[model samples]
Target: MKIAIVGATGLVGREIIRICEELLPHEATYTLFASSNSAGTKLKVNEKVCEVKELKEENIETYDISLFSAGGERSKKFAKSFLNKGSYVVDNSSAFRMEEEVPLVVYGINEDKISKETKLISNPNCTTMGLVMVLKPLHEKYKLEKIVPTAYQAVSGSGRAAVESLKNEEKLGEELKPNYRDGFYTRPISRNVIPLAGNLTENGYSDEEMKFVNESRKILDIKSLIVEPSNARVGVETGHGVFCSATFQKEVDVKEAIDVLNSFNGVQYWEETLPTPLDAEGSNDVLVGRMRKGLSSNKILNFWSVSDNLLKGAALNAVQIASYIVQND
Candidate 1:
């Protein structure tokens, strides 16, 4: 069998290559794809040095599975081409997510939504994936009425440019200064927190914030689920952290909530020390802690969670979808 990795030269794309080697079948061959600028570059995948090909229709070939993390626009343009050639496409972009027919999936949560006839699957936004892993089981125990999620997202979630911006600002000693303005982001990422994490929409929310709201509703199958999300880009390098307060129909039991979270497949509930972004780097599990009843009501529960944005959030989830297809096929 053959597999394709699109965006092989990118941040998440390179992680995907590393995971494909670790998780996929030993015999499955690898092909890497990138834009013209990265084309002809070499990357080692599955112990073989492969040339990164240009992502053009003329260069395409049929493969068993294709994993995409290029970007939304590129996925929209090229993903169907892979599907037409009979490859199962697991996309890590906003492209097909929210399409009425497309299945937006989180591996341990709503992955059962994928099926035999499924041609393309979507990985949720990095922060949303971490948020819902905590919410899904809690919702099962106590029907979730509303959610207020405040995110401290790592710069790595934005891309290599954002990460570089953080590093560059720190190196230039601009971040330590009172007034520092030059970076790829609107604000310097070092020694700072930027409230504007994405493009502003007419509704006064960011595209990233809206992704959290809408994607949560879709993944949980709750059309009217209330999600009040506020996101910020933090100086951290890898993990994304979310603090959530949820109101439910049933009163929350602190002990029971901890057990429920710990028992969940992809979640690790912490008791003594609250999990931090530093702890989540390179880990697959979403770390949850600071569980307690909300100040005002027993029906409300507040908790904090952290996860590696690149792994469980993006590349790893895409590869898991491919694994699910392979195992179930």
Candidate 2:
């Protein structure tokens, strides 16, 4: 089967290649595409060298599947072309995720949303991906009433440039200032935390914050669910974490919640420990810990959820959706 990896030169794109190598069928051949600047780059997949091609209309080709990690604009421009050519698409972008017709799927949670007849699937935001993995079991056992999530996202979630900015600033070692505000983010991102993640929308919510609110509701199939989120960017390079206080319609039991998290396939629970960014880095499963009753409420459940933004958060989730299509097909 012919497969295409759009944005093959990017951080997540390269990660998709690595994951597909590990997860997808070995007999499947890959075609790589990227922006003009990265088009000629060569990447290794399964010990074979593949050259990246410029993504353009005339170059569109048919494939059994296409894994896209390019940003929204490119997905909006080129994803349909791949679909029209009979390729099933698993997009890792905010674009097309909320469309009325497109299914915003979190594999293993709502993977049944995919059918053999379905051609396109959308991956949720990295933070939302990890959040819902933990939330799904809880929601299944107890009806979800609301979620208040404060996400501490890694710089790598913003891509390679953000990581570079953090590294470059770290070099200031002794020279770093308290008000050192510059570079890719609105404020300094080294040895510090920026309370604002994405650019704030008119409603005073950062785009990233709103994404958690919207994507969670959609993926969990709870349209009326209330979600209040605050997103912050941290100095760490990878692994996004969300501290959530979730209120459920039914009374929750801490032991039962621990049991459910432990039983879930893609989740790991640290009953005796809490996970940090370093602990969760390089891990595919969403690491969850600190389960307890929320302040003043038995119906409210609190927990910490974390995952590798590059793996489960972006690349793995996209490929998992593609794997679902392949299996069901």
Candidate 3:
């Protein structure tokens, strides 16, 4: 396979490069693409230093697949251009996720949705990807009815600027004020938690919150499923931890639920080896643990799920989708 990674100089894009090298089948060639500003920059992929190339329409038709994490606008502008040229676009942006034509896929949960006709497949939000892995097995057995989720998302979810802000803030000592450009977080992300993530819409749900509610339904194929989520930003470098309480259609057997979750792919129940941000640091699985039943509602349950935002959340998911397309098609 010949692969091209767009946004190659960004954090998630860089991780995609690492994953491609780590997961490549023995016979494969990789290419790195970035904006002109980063064109001459050099990156090390599988021990070799490769220079980034400028991304232009004329040069976009040379690869079999493109994994993108640049942002919505860049994807909106160029994804179809690549797809039209027969390059499968596994997008990591929010742009095409909800579109009727695009399939929002999480590799273990719903990889079969992919096909040759599905040119631009959207990867779900990082938080959604981690949560759905745990939810899918339970939903399949008990039929999830309602969910209340609160996310303690890390600074890496905001992008490279937020990661650097925490480092700079650590040097100075206290929580500083937000300085628009260089500081990626909208508010001071140092020693405090920010209640907001993404833009706030008319319904009062931040775009990040809506992604959890909306994308969960799409991935689960349950449009009427109720998901109440509070998305917040915390001062962590990696890993988005979600504290979720969910209700099922029937009273779930706690032991059976636990056993089923333990059996699910990408879940970390039986093996202590399941990756966390540090273990999943460069890998693809979502880590889950500490499951319990709500004392009051027979149908309700609680659990914690964590995943490296750059990997399971973005890059790895994109690559997994691309790999699924190739194998299944």
Candidate 4:
């Protein structure tokens, strides 16, 4: 099998390569592609060193599958070209996610949505990926009526520029002043949390928050599900932590919910121990804990979940999709 990774020099792109090396280690041939500015930079796939190539339409046809981590605009422009050439595209951008024709997929939750006929697949936002992974099993056991999810997302979700900004702010320590006009973030991110993540929409919800609403609906195939999302940018360097309170249509038993989450694929749930971002940083599994009954309703359930935003949220999910496609083929 031949595969190509677009945006090869970016943060998620690099993770994609690392995962591809670890997962599809033996047989697949790999190529790296990035923008002209990043082209010619060297990157490693397993032990072999390869230089990044410029992403172009002509070059896309050479691979059987292409994993795109470039931003939405680039994916909008180039993804179809790859698909037109008969190469399946697993996109990690929000580009075609809500498109009626495109399938928005989470590897374990709804991978069965993928079939031989699927040519273009959209990966959910990092926040949505972790939320839906834990929600799916619970939703199956007791149908979901509503979800209130507040995310403590890592700076890595904003790409390398935001991560650099945090590092620069940390180096300056207490002396660091807010550069509201100059930085990529709206406010100082180091030793701070920004309540708004992504741009605000007309409805007052940030795009990142709405992704939790819309993408979860699509991935879980629940069109009428009520999702209220509060997405925040935390100071952490990696791993996204989400605290969710859910209302189910039926009465929920805490023990039963814990069992369902623990047995579910791609997720780990514990009763006595709780998961933190540090535990999730390099792991593929979404960790869930701190399960308890809601204050007001017996039907309500609350829990905490954490996962590496770059891994399970983006690169690893895309690679897993590609692996499933290959295995089925």
Candidate 5:
């Protein structure tokens, strides 16, 4: 099998290469693609050096699978072309996520949503990925009606430039000027938390916040589930943390909920210890903890979930989809 990773030099792209090297069969070969400026750069995959190529229309058909983390514009432009050439695409950007024909999938929660005929799959946003992992089991038993989630996301979610800005802040100070290449972020990301993530929509919710609502509903197959989300950027550099209060149609038993979480695939629950960014940074599993009854009502349950934004939240999930395709084939 041959795989092509677009945006090969980006943070998520690099992590995808590492995961592909670790999990994919050794017989598979990988090709890296980047912009013209980065095209000739060398990248190491599975300890083997490979030169990054400029993505072109002519070369997209050479791979069986393509993983895209090259921002939405690139994915919008190139993903369909790759799919048209018979290569399955797992896009990490928001490009095709809400498309009626595209299946927004999380490996354990909604792998069944993918079919032999499906060629393009969308990876959920980092915050949504961790949130739904914990919500899936509970929703199955209790039936979720509404959810209010507040995400404390990492700098890495923005891009390498944001990560560099945070590092520079540590060396300089919080007042450091915005140096992000694209000016993607509105404020400094170090020593403080920014309440706004992504652009604010006309309805007042930021794009990142709405992703939690829209993507969760799609992945859970719940069209009417009410989701109110507040997404924020924190000083942390790796994992994403989500705190949510979920209201159910029926009464929930905390013990049963804990049991359900423990039994769920791709999630781990702790009773005494709560998961943090430090605990989740290098791990593939979504670490869930602090499960209890919500303060407001008996029908509402509150919990915390954490996962490596780059791993379970992005690269690992995409690779898992690729692996599933290979296994099924």
Candidate 6:
């Protein structure tokens, strides 16, 4: 299949190219798309070099599949333009997620929502993807009542600039520059933890936190499930960790919950084999372990979940969703 990756020079886009080269046996053609500023740049796929092109409505119509990882503004403007031209778009932005027509998909969770008529598919936020991979199976076993998740998100989740800023701050000392007002983050992201991501809505939740609440409900088909999310940026490089404490509607059997998590799709739990950033860095599966039930609360369960924010969190999930559509439809 011919694929065009919009924002192909960005971190997630680059990883998508690498994954396609590694996993796909078919000789697929890849067209890389970037903004006007990055149009002339060249990115390597396998040993071959492909020049990045500027996205145009006419050019976008040429590919069978288009993966969009550029921010919302670009997606909002050009996503439909590509789709209107008869291309399937698997977007990694929050732009069209809540739209009724667009399916917000995690490949193994709700991939069946995609159909031949579906042109635009939205991939959930990085944290939401990790949370749902662990929550979906558990939700099926015992209905969830509430979830309190506190995340130790890696710096890479912010974007390439934020990761570079952290590296630069380490060499130039931990002093905030007037010009460098945290371009992709809310506060000083070096040697410090930022308690928020995105803007605070009128309801007092940041856009990132609200994604966990709303997307989980939509994916799990469980609205009115109380989700309290506290998102923070840590100084790590890759892999996001979530410490989740969940309350179910009924008394959950501890062994049963563990068995369910062990059997869930998109989750890897080889306790002896460590699934860190080094292992899951470019893979599609979300790694979940350290699961335990709260002794005090019969309804509560505690666990930790982790995944490479660039892959399962963004590009790989988008690709898996596309693969599912192609196979099922």
Task: Please give, for residues 1-329, the per-residue lDDT of candidate 2 as tens digits.
Answer: 88899989888998999888988899889999999998778899998999899999998889999999889999999999999999999999899888877888888798888875668888899999999999999999999989999999999998888888899999998687877777678788888888988889999999999998889989999999999999999988999989999999999999999999889999999977789889988898999999989788889998898999998899988888878777888
State the displacement of the C-alpha of residue 150, model 6, in Å, after optimal TM-score superposition. Answer: 1.0
lDDT score at residue 328, model 6, on the 0-100 scale: 63
Q: Count the backbone clashes (under 3 Å) in each candidate.
A: 0, 0, 0, 0, 0, 0
Cα TM-score of candidate 2: 0.97
Against the true structure, what is every candidate's RMSD? 1.2, 1.1, 2.5, 1.3, 2.1, 2.6
lDDT of 3 by residue, 66-179 (tens): 888888888998888888877888999999999988999998988888877887899999999989999999999999988999998888898887788878875655436555
How far residue 289's Cα lies from its native spot in candidate 5, in Å, is 1.9
Estimated TM-score per prediction?
0.97, 0.97, 0.92, 0.97, 0.95, 0.91
Better of 2 and 5 by lDDT: 2
lDDT of 1 at 37: 95
Runs off by more than 4 Å, candidate 3 = 175-182, 270-283
Looking at candidate 2, what is the lDDT of residue 17? 93
Off by over 4 Å in 1: 174-179
- lDDT for model 6, please: 0.81
Looking at model 2, the pairs that clash are none
Those runs of model 2 whose alpha carbons end farther than 4 Å from true positions after fitting are none
Question: What RMSD does model 5 have?
Answer: 2.1
For residues 1-329, write the lDDT of model 6, one tens digit per residue: 67788989888888878777765434678889988889889888777789998887656646678899888999999988878767789999899999888888888888888887888899999988988898888888888889999887888887788788778766656456544564456556666667876678999988888998998888887888999998878766778878899999888876788678778877876466655555666556788667778777988898877888998899788877766665665
What TM-score does candidate 3 reach? 0.92
- The CA lDDT of each predicted structure is 0.90, 0.90, 0.82, 0.89, 0.89, 0.81
Q: Per-residue CA lDDT of candidate 1, range 1-329, in tens?
A: 89999999999999998888888898899889998999889898867889999999998899999999899988999999999999989999999898988899999888888886878888899999989999999999999889999999999998888888888888876426646777878777788888878889999999999999999999988888999999998888999999999999999999999999889998999888878999999898999998989999999999899999999999888888888888877
> For model 5, what is the C-alpha lDDT against the true structure?
0.89
